[model samples]
Target chain A: GAGVSQTPSNKVTEKGKYVELRCDPISGHTALYWYRQSLGQGPEFLIYFQGTGAADDSGLPNDRFFAVRPEGSVSTLKIQRTERGDSAVYLCASSLWGTSTGELFFGEGSRLTVL
Target chain B: GESVGLHLPTLSVQEGDNSIINCAYSNSASDYFIWYKQESGKGPQFIIDIRSNMDKRQGQRVTVLLNKTVKHLSLQIAATQPGDSAVYFCAENGAESKLTFGKGITLSVRP
Candidate 1:
């Protein structure tokens, strides 16, 4: 893909339901990241991946939020037993390399509304 | 606990005027800082970035200034336009390649 791609642009799920958001990073990009943005706030870091390994997951918030990138290209963010407070836009980004100096290319984001 | 914050929550400027947005980060270890612009119903787009070694960097009609002594970062937009109306965010590269972002400042350009 020319840029980062995300699926399920919008999702409305009931409380306690499980939902998954997908992201397809640009070809040959080795670094992928996930972020969540609440209303009137900036994007918060959720997780970061270097290749197929999760280099960091400290910002996942809780045990209910999980993400995976098995192939080093596509990633998925899975939320279990979703709560109303979890309503936000989930964003995905990719970089040519997982370096601090590289700029991240962002996707359109998946808006999840937990009702 | 290191965190990033903005001095102002919102800023209103006239079109064609220069606009400046400020942000402060607590981490001194951060070596890179980036500014992003996010419009309604869209994701954040990269505006500009400055490295710790450089105090300033410039792009097309935009400039980013970094003050490592105070851990402050700022973005300047020249000749602001209506299209520049969006929420501006400052992010600092933290441990493990994570970018910690500030709350953001909403910039409104009035015609």
Candidate 2:
């Protein structure tokens, strides 16, 4: 079975520009999550979706960051006005169940560079 | 938006030695803890997980020890090899469904 997959392995954009990153979760996974990883640091939670609605998004850093999962399988993280600080790897993961107790399968991730 | 964090920034161990990484979490209600290994240019890979109920759980060559009283967690790897070099992060999920992660410890293997 295919693991989680993300598109545009690398993306470079100017500051203040808008961009979107996509995620395709594993089949039969009812839970999906988004995280941000900075250099020499750990991944910070962004948001999580259970089915078609976001179950938890309190981790989102600010209003500039937003995510959506319309059909319950794939998701997209959108940035309204990118900043240099927003440059990092955007990771997407999914699990068999919706709870945090289950193990997660992660994608390689999409590296976003804002200059 | 506080989260779990690591006690040590880095650890350097020789091949065939044992390595222990520590993490401290603030949320006591966090019953679930997970250890993830992330290599350069890749996303985090699940290494092992332990619930608050049990004090210890073992995997292939890795073990997770959780102490709810101190709100601390540790990952022990026996006979550490060069391939085990990577960044280790501990995540805790409390009553909240979100899994907050630690600062991470970089493991360097000296062969």
Candidate 3:
């Protein structure tokens, strides 16, 4: 796809279970980001990857949330011991540069529901 | 901690009228700001962006104004259309590469 693509558009899991969400950015994009959005709120920065390295993961709520962009193309966000509070829409975006100074192309996002 | 926030949760304007959405940021070091529009069940699309160096930037039917003195940002849509009805968010980028977004404001255009 010419745009960002995210898999598992909807994921419902029980509390304490683990989940993984995938994101495929536009070809040739060097920068990728992950954000979490709860109901009625905007996306909160989660992590940022420049190429194969995570330049910043300061936004990760805790050690349980982790993301990786291997080969600098496809990325995955992993969550462990999912809690009800973790239920939200996880959005992935990519840009040509590793900075927020430019426009970012975003995916449709993955909606996670914890029960 | 830095935070971005919108002035209001919702704004209603008549079709063909101009609409303005306001946002405020607590970080004084932010240098870049962006506005994004999100429709139902869709990801946010970029609208326009302004740097702290410039006070205003204009796009197709959209204008973004930034005030560094007060740390305020406003997005103006000329001649609001039904298609313009969506949730709008203002984001700020500081020294870090990541962007911090505020709670969005829902714009409703009434015909």
Candidate 3 deviant stretches above 4 angstroms: none
Q: Look at candidate 3 and tell me the lDDT of residue A55.
A: 94
Assess every candidate by TM-score: 0.97, 0.96, 0.98
Model 2 bad stretches (over 4 Å):
none
| Model 2: fnat (fraction of native contacts) | 0.69
Second chain TM-score per prediction?
0.98, 0.96, 0.98
Give the worst 10-residue stretch by lDDT in candidate 3 chain A: A98-107
Candidate 1 chain A: 10-residue stretch with minimal lDDT: A96-105
RMSD of 1: 1.0
Candidates ranked, most accurate by DockQ first: 3, 1, 2
Highest DockQ model number: 3
DockQ for each model: 0.78, 0.72, 0.85
Docking class of 3: high
How far in Å is the alpha carbon of A92 misplaced in model 2?
0.5
RMSD of each: 1.0, 1.3, 0.8
- C-alpha displacement of A54 in model 2, angstroms? 1.1
Please give the ranking of all candidate structures by TM-score, highest first, separated by commas.
3, 1, 2
Better of 1 and 2 by DockQ: 1
Selected candidate, larger TM-score, 2 vs 3 = 3
